[model samples]
Target: MLVNTFLPLPEFITGNILWLAKKGFAITLFLIGTDLSLKVIKTVGIKSVLFGVILWAFISILSFIVITVF
Candidate 1:
């Protein structure tokens, strides 16, 4: 969304923002993934996990379709 909404700007500023955002995303994923355990997964249940994956897949496909069509 931010990428789609950003206005035209100087190349250096845009490059910095893109670099920082990528780093932030990597750190966030690392933090979230580090805490995973069998107990947590079992507590959440297989059904819930599978449902979330399916939902994510559907949204990803939809996004791809819309982006391509437009």
Candidate 2:
């Protein structure tokens, strides 16, 4: 942001930078997916999974309520 303020980029360069940022984001997600281990989840046990599901559901419901009410 500071660099952009000092030396403004042209429209085409800014567009290319956005494209590169998106590609980098996709590559990062793919790398993270490749490193993920399903076996670790299995070892963590069903109770932990159930607790996570409950927490997720609670958060989802709370956010929905907040959005609708606000």
Candidate 3:
């Protein structure tokens, strides 16, 4: 939606947005990789792994709700 606000933006800023979009994918991938690595490090056994996964899912959902609401 924010991206849509910039329809017909001046060329320079438009280019910047395109560049940011490209870089954003890389950033997201890196973050996901780091998160998985941390989970691997913290895993103890099957029970702990399940709890960690559930906790991560809950946190992710909460974050999504907060971002969308705000």
Candidate 4:
């Protein structure tokens, strides 16, 4: 069940990257805005941000391993 929830992540990421590439500077600005927002949120006592970052790192590493292995 948990694995199923994340099954579409790679596809989602690929689509997002393609969309970003197509949009060029606009997408870059959006991503930068999101980063700034996240930083502000973290500064405002959002402790879960660290956990989210760790989770993202773990999932990214797992995805890399799966891709390399196959």
Find the candidate with the highest lDDT and give its number: 1
Worst 10 residues of 4 by lDDT: 1-10
Higher TM-score: candidate 1 or 3? Answer: 1
Ten residues in sequence with the least summed lDDT for candidate 3: 36-45
lDDT of each: 0.81, 0.80, 0.76, 0.73
Error of 3 at 32 (Å): 11
lDDT per residue (tens digit) for residues 1-70 in model 4: 3554776557777777768767997756965866757567667555666676689899999999999999
In model 1, residue pairs whose N, Cα or C atoms come closer than 3 Å (at least 3 residues apart or on different chains), thus clashing, are none
How many residue pairs clash (N, CA or C atoms closer than 3 angstroms) in each of the candidate models, in the order given?
0, 0, 0, 0
Better of 1 and 2 by lDDT: 1
Model 3 C-alpha lDDT per residue in residues 1-70, reported as the tens digit of each score: 3765866667788788789988998867965876655556556566776786799899999999999999
Backbone clashes in candidate 3 total: 0
- Compute the lDDT of residue 22 as modeled in candidate 1: 97
Report the alpha-carbon TM-score of model 4 versus the true structure. Answer: 0.42
Question: Which 10-residue window in model 2 sums to the lowest lDDT?
Answer: 30-39
Q: Global lDDT for candidate 1?
A: 0.81
Candidate 4 at residue 14, lDDT?
A: 70
Ranking by lDDT: 1, 2, 3, 4
TM-scores of all models? Answer: 0.50, 0.45, 0.40, 0.42
CA lDDT, candidate 1, residue 11: 79
TM accuracy, model 1: 0.50
- Model 4 spans > 4 angstroms off: 1-35, 38-44
